[model samples]
Target: MGKSQKQRAIRRHNPMRVPDTHLPKGLASASSSSSKNEAVLPIIQKMESPEVGERKWACVAVSNIIQNDPSTRRLLQGKNVVGALIARLTDSEEEVVVEAMGSLRNLCIDGGYDICAEMYNKNILTPLKAFVPKISTTLEQYLANPKAAPENAAKLVYEFADNVITTLWCLSETSNKALNAINALQLVPFLMSFLACRDRLPLAPVTAAAQCLYVLSDDNEPAIDEVRSNGEFITSLLAIARTVSDARTSHGKVDIRRLQLGVLASGVLKNISPLPLAVASDIDIDKELVTMLLPVLQNTSLRDATARVPVLLSEQANEVAVDKPSLKNTPKSDHRSPVEIELESIENQLRTTQLALEILTAACATLPDPDVSKHDEEADEQEDEGMEEEEIDEGVNDEMSVEGVPSKDEVKSSVDLLPSLVPVLIQLAEPTALSFPPLANPSIHPPTTSALGAVHIAALECLNNIFLSLARNPSSTVQADTVAAKGIWDGLWKSLGLVGTEFGLGQERRKQFWELAIGVLWGVSMVWKGFLAPDAQEVELLKLFCNSSEDERVRVKCIGTLECLAQCPTAVDGNKIIAEYLFTLLPTDTTPPAGVEPAIQAGSALIDIYSDETFPYDVNFRANGYLERLVAHVDAMKKLVKGIDRRKPGGRELRLRGEEVRDNLVAFLKYRKALKL
Candidate 1:
């Protein structure tokens, strides 16, 4: 491609370059990335070329490697690829600089933590120190005289800004040393420059700045102090988050990008909000802003419909996702030119939804009991009117320049918010099965599933918080009787287990979800064996325990749910119900464990049965070949242990667990082989 054409390609499809908004596992195929690496040394040699085209092409090729295959990302870490790109940051040619910065920015991203540490070790910020000011100088010049410059000049400035800001943000995300270096650069004000008068700026750089500022401000006292002092900046962020970027798409439909922009803006506010003590008095409209923004908290309609937007959001600028039947008949909006819309992604939409749920969870934690038991006309009116704007030209238009987000009391809804909130949250908490994004070629999950998984986890977290908060709040309308509300319990029981079962989600998230389940649901499970116990035809927990796919901690958590339920203090019948359930899964005279899985299952049930405080210790149990049954379980575990090849990935852990189960069985000899019970 020619230079101008290449710049447009960078503009129209900037998948890997935009810092923090990376999709989990990335969008490129592993095979595609792998195939590109055969030319690594040639590319590195080209990167040192005197010719701008060769150097730029080299950088672009390295970026392609970074984006497509994580295996290649790992492979490139030890090579001269990163060092070669860092050298191009100061290249006399602007295109070479852009390409090099883009390649290095991406390396820090999907390339993973080791790459960031590598960049830091290479002293990346040294070249970046000079590079930041160069972009700043050109950007200001363009803003001063946009029309005077040739076409694509301003776009180049914005692209430069996007790559630089995102690169800085990615470095800070992984290493504190890089963050300190960035802070020394004093880039916060420059980042804030994109926020105040965003009308003249392209949305791409503005979103990049917003995302970077949000990330850099986190937990850094110096950055937070800088952010806190700028009340107008804070208020503008809140307003942008509260309102849409633009009202319509080319088709005159509500632009999905508009919602995504608000989400990005809100994400910054989420980091800074419930403002610190020093600047607390400066911004005066806090409660009003909360009232305005609260509706997003209750609105579940903001979910990304890949059918309504492109499957790969990089292609979104060139194509409108017209897969939805509703969008089919809608006439295309001719008002805004194709040049006007900024890039937005399904990843952004998912992140936005998760942020809203998370904010609501925090808000609900502080909420007083409902003043009224049902939502009334007044609360509904505020919700309806608070955020729906008529329009704001093509930019901030003065309406976005709020002076403050100062505090006052919140709008305690006249009617309960939970009835409306819970159902949507329940839907979010479940595993999503959206059709349009399509599963990646070989992977079973869709391109957007990791993002969706985050939304689901966020919804569950919010739900868990609601459960505990309402249960204890004396004035709260959500009545947690002795157990979860009938509706809440019914909605979550199956999905909760399924959430822990999803492979796409990190095991830590699944572990956190399971632990939260026990904390909130154990009382109910102890009361109702159906929640924790395996049934006649199938067993969710037992199968999960044996399924090799599940992480050991997650499996421990799943089984931990049962172990905790058995010991929980509930009604007298709770223990009896649990004991009867355990006995059914244990080995009997005719039914020894059929295989390794069944053997593990039998051992787990035996432990619970032998340990149950209220277990009906029947002499008839041992009389019915109980000793023989114990021997069978022990023998099964022995075979399970002998079968392990300890050299394999999980084999050692499997062998250890098998031995542990066998030992636990033999430890039961007093009541088992002796038949003394």
Candidate 2:
């Protein structure tokens, strides 16, 4: 009985035993093999079949195999496959035709423009068009679902559109069908309809549409006008764009809604301009829509991104205006109520408001100058040079003489309200910061995101405009004073250490701040080239920025400013000034302020300048020891991390440090190696 049980256990557990060929275990494995064979058998079996349905399936199977299987797909080129697929499009069997079309689509998928171009050249596009209704039907099915993958659909549509658009262009370029290419133009309606559907206009379509619009808009006579008229054909395109541009979607996404608004703006502007060839007897846009749209173009947000020129066809009024003070603030009257300590809440809010007002006042010192000079130049140039002297003498020119192009005071007053608008832009930044508990309650700190970054951007822009205005000054009387430039430098310095880690910041905000800081400093560096001439206080401020334990971006800015300083014509010993302390705070081997990649790039840019290859030795000039030491330190650090493993957290920190160190070391070593001594 023990032996029998042992034998049973052995039979049940036969883990290493090989099965007999004819046994059920082997038979099951054989069945799997047989099924795979059957799955593949049909493809090859039908390849040369006389049956129409069989032939179509063969074309599809080969196409699918070529598309899905790497080995088979390689066989699709420069051969009978394209010809065979094209011929099968004429097959009577529907399945055959569909499969053939599907295979051709697959070939075109990977083939890109060359194959599409080839197909168009071969007049193979005629059959391709026949398949569009089928493709569009499929596209519509995908679009109907609320959860449709908009991106995937866009790619497919772009592919189809590319083939069609290119084909149409080629056809149009020739003597063939300059006007009537029904096959190509019909697809335009499908694309336009997709724009309305919301699921159709993904990033790819936005890109494709830009390209497609340019292609379709290119006509010789009234070309711009012809493009504007397209809006008339499909008015809903503008409507969809408007809807998308205005939408903010969930928190933190780019207001694609704003983008669509710009497209609408562009389309509208196109319609207004050189296009339509005739000024409308009456324009469709009312004054209010004009008011709403003009601000968008005027907004600093769109100006930098779109570079739209906000032409004042006529001077438009500000939408939300601060009314002129009706009466001056009078000394408290005897009738005034007693002090209201009970309303502490009101007092705190008032204090907060006053603080914001002060910041804006300080920020305004940075804004760019207005275009007064250009206006003045035009005003001076238009003097009766063209008119006959006798005719000019006979005419009463008093009515035609414009009141001296708006005074500087008038321009300043018109834009003075900009400081007031700073708060609203700050309010937009507050929710993102979460540092300040919103603007409703009184707080010591302003909203960090809005006040720090947004204000910085606005300040930079205003400074740019101010500089531009100064550049345009007709009179040598107005110049960029050190006081104004100093105020800007001080303001930027105060904000320097405040911009912390970049992880929580938006890319646009970060970019804006960096750009503003770099630009302003570059300008300031130019203005104060010889730091030698600045007052004692300005020199002290420079010293603090270089040596202080401030924020990293600020340090980065200082380094950048120092680099710019190096370029200034008036800079005396600029290299000596920067070389003294820059290496201490912004060591190339360390993780930079915010520890962001861009900060690292900025550091690398500085180190590159220190290399001897960059600054080859000229014995006549003093040797730059500071640059030499910086290179040496980077080298020692690089050698220490060379053999260390870096997959773990400790390793990662090492790698970050190691990367900076390595770049610095390599740069330094390269210079050191190049030294003759």
Candidate 3:
């Protein structure tokens, strides 16, 4: 990990990704060009109708039209559709109010952040306030006699309850001001009640309640306090997420819905991890959650790893989604069509796997307090100085903890789980096994066997953080570095375990681990032959990864690893294979996008490769097209550097690095000319 990527805010499955399974769909989705026709205007006008039926129909129509259509959502918002929907929320008919709440929830989902703020500005929460208490009453009555509440409400009470709760959850997530209003609902205990009734109630309503809790407890002080207060709620949610069911359907298939419910339940725990949710005063939530999640990662059936000839090189290779789950390709079926079921099941499996990795990632993410006084710089430096002195004076090392607490780099529970985590992360981090005869073209995304490339990417990210956390702690037994020269002389990477040790690598893992191990070698000051002469396996791994057409973003990670290797003088080597692969990533036919970060990474590496005294392919500089490529890459870097906006944050540093790289390349060229070799 570079300085830029050392710390990251834990990721959440975007709350706005509304699974509107019961929402209106299959109606003609209004197109973007319909904006000019004022198509939603008529619907908005009808939404204000005096007749309840007309208003109800219009609300459902709006929901149907805008569920997956951002263009129509914008068009609706422009026509004051939010205000009209808010009007429907207070309709005399409860049915109309429920449908309207559903529409507004879809708007919040489809319209993105702006529409959410607009709904808040319209005071949607004022009506939303009454539904919580009402649902609490309905839930109790319905649980007592499952059919009784629906008969009384005239519509299924659970659906009515779900819409209201989910709608409030969506709105609260998007707008900060909406939190206070939602917190006042005193909704934690009520939502927990719904979660407790999951076995009896429909999954949608149960999921809605869990989702409501997730949004509430995520970084919100008042809401987190509410969750900590309702101890059993958190306990039950984690238990559902943790339990892997063997319940078979009548068709003898796995009960996937129950499993997906686990995904939702786990997602709630993931969203608010590191916040203790244990009911028992003695139990530790972090350790308990880790124990529960380890088995989820251990299920080897989930990983359907694929091997293929590089897609750019093969005739049989089809284009896989670079980012799967694009909105445009989402199944259009309002009902559970075969296509929809297949896609949903695939996505659900991917989500389940990802949620497991993310929860582990988040649990391990012991990031420094973001708001904890940046102005105390002198204090931080003094502390660092003290930590170093303490390590040195003692000769051995300080315990990785202080007062039984882990450092900023690791979560206590995560450190305990690393022995298990390392093996799982390394295995999952492997890309679609690309059979590469190094293509000259820039890396293209290939057909990953079981899609969800995000799962692989997430695994890598979580692994990177773990590597950092373990390496930085002196007391950590996880080997992250070799000594400067003797460590290299004795056996290269032996200390770091990339070559040999507890976390030993196989043919595939060696490469994936090689890319990650760059951060481990970052500060080691060694000018040794081992750095220059990588073993055949290590070089082959680099060659495959740099040219691997798995995912472009994953390829960028390799480029970044290369860039880090190039930046350090001790780490840089005269490996011809590494240079050839680096050049293959840069474009020759086109001037690359000036603002693209990947282009910067490749260019920066190129400059470093040629700038130093040792050149990867110095003998074939002119014959092998290295000279021509160098000049072209330099020109491209110059253009990008000049075009960069130096006024922005890190902009000046980026531009300066580009200039330095270019200057060093020029000096190297001059030295080559003077030597006449």
Candidate of highest TM-score: 1
RMSD of each: 17.1, 27.0, 12.6
| Model 3 agreement with the true structure over 439-557: per-residue lDDT tens digits | 23312322222233445556655765554454344333323323322332223243223232212211233343445444333322111212433444545544454454344444555
Residue 617 CA error for candidate 3 (Å)? 15
lDDT of each: 0.54, 0.40, 0.55
Model 3 clashing residue pairs (backbone) = none
- Candidate 2 regions with alpha-carbon error over 4 angstroms: 1-48, 66-72, 129-227, 245-677
Single out the weakest 10-residue window by summed lDDT for candidate 3.
Answer: 394-403
Task: Write the number of the candidate with greater TM-score, choosing between 2 and 3.
Answer: 3
What is candidate 2's CA lDDT for residue 404?
26
| Deviation (Å) of 415 in candidate 1 | 10
TM-scores, all models, native as reference: 0.61, 0.30, 0.59
Q: Pick the candidate with the highest lDDT.
A: 3
The better-scoring model by lDDT among 1 and 2 is 1
